[model samples]
Target: MNEDFYIDPDIHQSYTLPASVYTQQQYFDVFKKELFLPSWQWLGGKEWSDSLYTQMPHSFLPGCVDEPLLIVRNQNQLSCLSNVCTHRAKILVESPSAKPFISCGYHGRCFSPDGRFRSMPEFEAAQDFPSSKDDLKNYPLSSWNDFYFTALQPKYDLNTILAPIHQHLSSFPYDSLRPEPNLSKTYHVRANWLAYCDNYLEGFHIPYVHPTLNKAITYEDYEVRVFDHCNVQIARCKPGQKPVPLQKGDPDFGQNIYAYYWFVYPNFMINFYHWGISVNWVLPKTTDETEIRFLTYKRNDIPDSDFADTALDLTEIEDEAVVESVQKGLMSLTYHRGRFSPTREQGVHAFHRFIYTEVFADSENIAP
Candidate 1:
């Protein structure tokens, strides 16, 4: 398996990723280190006020990456850091606290709000004991609206990677959106994470599977816009439904654009609706299991029909059924590869190309 492989760059001339990606444990275990860890992913849709620091302790893609992360807030600045103490490998910040200081529970070591080492007990006699290495390891952190993102070794600047999101939503008043914990949800799906992502990257199944969402959206006018490291699917509202009106100079000005289903590279999804946003994170648990989290942020008052829990549940149920079935079908030796609709599946194709380039490229160039 050390030999390098390739994913055909041209979608028109390419086959889908091997079925083993969704069915075999060897592939998952191998890719877990080189690919998933360094890639940018949504950490449980954890939203924090960029203006204020909120202690947010989250596991990165819990089951698959399972990296314990700490989001620290000191005064007005925010940062993400390794939750493990470097001194003795002890977990730090077991829970969120309002204090403006951090202390390692294992020893008397202390760090400032920004993760810089401040003080240590009984180290006066130690030669050069306190250094930058003793500081809490910090991760790169950034935000778009209420969404916060972090990566240990991001391949590119997150601002550059998500430029599409910022450009498309530049004119919107999404700043009004506030985190609503009561509305967030999590679901365990009996399917591989990639299988779940595959289903999410297309809308061809909406009419067949999601009757409620189908009624809310017009299938004819929907469009998919592909970008580097991300993709956007336009969901125009059906008759009688309202959209947060677009302003002049906005990309979709003068259109009843109900939502923008934005899928960032890998497993993060930001579904923007008039009422608010439904942020989805696909967390891989095992070869055939995944945990999907839906964290909601509301901008203002929402009508029951536009953003109701029951409506969301119905859509999820339909999607889960289809993705789970696909997972089962991939187990068949008779089915190994399939083609994509050149028009409808560009997003899925783009996602596959990204997965291949990052996971299977000359791994010698990858960081250890």
Candidate 2:
């Protein structure tokens, strides 16, 4: 409820959303249309290989907004299809598998790997026979390293959003890093997904909220660099921590350790840690609820030990505490909006600007 901030048009600046955006159900309803549906998001990684097609259907977003989808490696091409049967809309592919074609258990409607309608029980008299409408809905899918990405209404190119990070990390052996299932976990937080993202946009609270992690990385050397709808904060690791060599001829050479914190606009965080990489995806279940999925990949066969588990758990719990508190505070009747620190909050500002552009672009009354 700090009111010292103003939206500066000269520099193309704006403040973060007021508390109501996180607390009120009405606002959250609009947020889904204005923010979530339009932005490019991280679905899941490309861990499902060609040989693993006929396994079990994976839940894309389970429990909250359960949009069941099927992933199949058909004719050597990876395809994602809506799991609902084209005949009666019954859920198909209950589990993952390597199957030649997807058959609906309810009525025998069959679909090809590319989501095309192939056969049905009694459809000979239909006028639009084998029409595209009968096929499963297909979403755009792309991949980086072994990680797969998708978008609902992808307005911008994935390459444009991820190009800089890709160039910087080109030489790093990301593909070599294997998924360590034991290290991955998910947390259901009682807060807006954006609230969680705001907490991650800066290192300002690190010295207080994450004492151990703060000590491991120097806050003074922390620098936030903004890109197109994305930002990267480079945090130099404390001495004695293992160092990750920068790509040859890269500008960030000679650094003892590199902690690359990347925020893909809307709600995905890809953190390049000293050990390997960790992907944090914030999925909105409702106005005041979010599901955070943490997937970790490791290099050099690092064993899953107590120290590693404790460090990860502590970091997550600390983040949840802060974000959840912020969500509650945003619900207060007296709260409104707050100012941004010009030096430390560039990431937050960049994100707000991106949101305004995506949401208010068509409104004639709103200034461009």
- Best model number under lDDT: 1
lDDT assessment of candidate 1 = 0.79
- For model 2, how does the per-residue alpha-carbon lDDT over 221-338 read when each residue is reduced to its tens digit? 7899888768988888777766555766665766765578899887889987657788888888887789998988776545444125467689889999999998888888888877
Per-model TM values vs. the true structure: 0.91, 0.89
Worst 10 residues of 1 by lDDT: 44-53
Total clashes in model 1, counting residue pairs 3 or more apart in sequence or in different chains = 1
| Predicted candidate 1 versus true structure: per-residue lDDT over 1-368, tens digit per residue | 22223456677766787687788887777667766777777643334553333566777777787788888876656788888887888887887777677778888788887888888888889898788898888888776665667787787777887899878878776766777788889999999999999889998888999988899889987899988879999989888878855788878888888789999877888887787788888888899999998888777655545665577778888899999999999999798787777778888888887877777675653333
Give the CA lDDT, 0 to 100, for residue 124 in model 2. 86
> Model 2 segments beyond 4 Å from truth?
1-14, 55-66, 301-309, 361-368
